[model samples]
Target: MRTLTTRAKVAWAVITVVVLVWALLPVVSIIATSFKLPSQLNLGTFWPKTWTTTNYEQIFAGSAKDLFLPALRNSIGISLIATFVAVVLATLAAYAIARLDFRGKKLILTTALGVSIFPVISIVTPLFNLWRNIGLYDTWLGLIIPYLSLTLPISIWTLAAFFRQIPWELEQAAQVDGATSWQAFRKAIVPLAAPGVFTTALIAFFIAWNDFVYGISLTSTSAARPVPAALAFFTGASQFEEPTGAISAAAVVVTIPVVILVLLFQRQIVSGLTQGAVKG
Candidate 1:
């Protein structure tokens, strides 16, 4: 690598600091607002005049119709189930595309890629009708199936790229040692693909957690509504007023798990992204 000039290095450092502040400003604002009392927030400054936990206490006091807790539980349950199902199905599908030489494979891969490019609105109506007929409407299963449409293609594509990077000779050698295809895959391929699997699961989890359109359009009851759907209640047409501080508190609550997941998987995400780009 060539050394950078002093001017170039200084300019790059300035750009990095600018970008970091740009990205973090909104997040810092949200967290700061969440800790303020409703009265303190009216002052309109970056920092709160008074810090209090009443916002969080009110949320846990069985007020707010228990919306916060239920929404939290629904989001976690749906995201975990959807992520598990999507990752398993995607892994198998990707393995076949990467390792097998079947007819129509190219067409299948192309179609999967095409599906990923389509917007969710394009099929929302049809999916709603189908779920209604099957009696899965407004149910966790209903939400899960639709979430698969959002997550599956991307998961398959990510895993397929990773699978292709593994040396073919390893699988061939396992076969020569009297292991069946499935056995060789389980014993050798799966372990090597752990990082990719974790990356796919993280993507699926976030997609399911953050989804709003289908969650709102399909579920009519609060019992089945996730955090994204529940957050809508904070905004009312008659703005006599909902507490901005409380809404910010709820947002902070919903964001915590996602932030934790990203931090925990930061290394894997970086590795998977670089590996996929370089290998594919």
Candidate 2:
């Protein structure tokens, strides 16, 4: 490998530092704000004058528990269900797309891409009315339905791309060793696709977890509302008070799962994304 010149190294280091500060400043601000006393909120200081855990306590121990806890449960339930369903369906569909010759394959891929980029707002109004009429509104299934719409397309595309990179010979070899088709697939194919499946599951979970539009628009109560929607409705300590600190605390709490997911699966995610980008 060729070494970078001194100037190039210096420039890259500067860029890295700038990007890190730019990305982390808002996150740091949220954490700092979450620890601030209500009286210290408007002090305009980056750090709290007197740190307190009141905001976090309010979310879990105070009146906000009714709203936050159920919403957290709904978020967990809905996101997991969506991720599981999307990955299973995508895996089968992607295997077909990657390994079989079928009519309309290109059309399916193109449509998937188009739907993934489709403006979600355009259909929200219609969906809202339909969901209301169909009795899915304010229900866990209601949110999961639309979340599949968001997650399925991307999951299919990513899994299809990953599947294309899997060598079919392994599957065939298993079959030659007297394994049935399903056995070969389950034992040979799925194991090789584990990384891709995991990465896709994480992506789908994030999509459903972070959703605000459908969560807020389709659900009216904590019954099925996720955290993002619940955060918007967080109340202050008093009628005259602002909910800024409490909201920050909830936001920080919500972010922990995403950070942990990324930390745990960083390598798999990177590998899944870059699988087909380079040809050997």
Candidate 3:
């Protein structure tokens, strides 16, 4: 590897620090806002004058609890379900693409790229009407299906790239040693692909978890509304006040699962990202 000169190193360091601050400033601001007392919002300070946990209490144990907790549960369930289904289906499709040199192999990757770039807004209105007619509107299944459309294409693309890099000899060796094709895949390929699979699942889950368009446009009630959507309905302490603090608290709470997942799986995530192919 080429070593950077002193001047180049300093420039890169400054760029890294600037990017970090740029990306993290909003998160830090929201966290600070979440800790502030309702009256301290417009105090024009980055940190609260009188820091308090009232916002957290409101979301967890007070008036907004009903809206926040149920939505949290819905977001978790729907995202997990979507991730699981997407990973399973994508794994199979990717394995086929990786091992088989059948027709349209390149076409599959091209289509996934196209679907990923397609505008999501264009489909929402049509989905809204279709769900209503099919009796799926405002239901967990309704949201989950839309989430799949957002997640599956990318999942397939990532896993296919990763799967292609895995040594074919491993699976072939297993099959030659009396293992069936399914056994070879389950016992050999799946174990080796765990990191990539897990990383893909986490990415898919985040996509579904953070979704607001489907969560807001498709669902009408707390029954199926995710946290992002539920934040819109938080009531204020009084008619004169906005629910900014409560909303901030709910946002912080919703972000915790994502943070924890990353912290716990950072190793696998980094490994997968580095080892997997970045493009079709």
Candidate whose lDDT is highest: 2
Query: Which segments of model 3 are wrong by more than 4 Å?
Result: 1-13, 175-186, 263-280
Q: Per-residue lDDT for 162 in model 2?
A: 88
**Cα lDDT computed for each candidate against the true fold:** 0.79, 0.89, 0.88
Best by the TM-score measure: 2
Instruction: For model 2, state the Cα shift of residue 191 in Å.
Output: 1.8
Clashes of each: 0, 0, 0
Q: For residues 10-109, could you state the per-residue lDDT of candidate 3 as single tens digits? A: 9999999999899789988999999999987998899999989999999889988899999999999999999999999999899899889799988887
lDDT of 2 at 72: 92
Q: lDDT score, residue 214, model 1?
A: 84
Badly placed stretches (over 4 Å) of model 1 are 1-9, 174-187, 235-240, 271-279
Ranking by TM-score: 2, 3, 1
Ranking under lDDT, best-scoring first?
2, 3, 1
Residues 1-280, model 1: lDDT tens digits: 9999999999999999999899788988988988887666768799877888767776666355377788778778887898899899989988898889998777866777788778888778998899889988888988888888877877887788888877867766898999999988778776887878889788767778889988887787766788888888654213665557667788888888778878888887776666544556
lDDT: worst 10-residue window of model 3: 271-280
- TM-scores of the candidates are 0.87, 0.92, 0.89
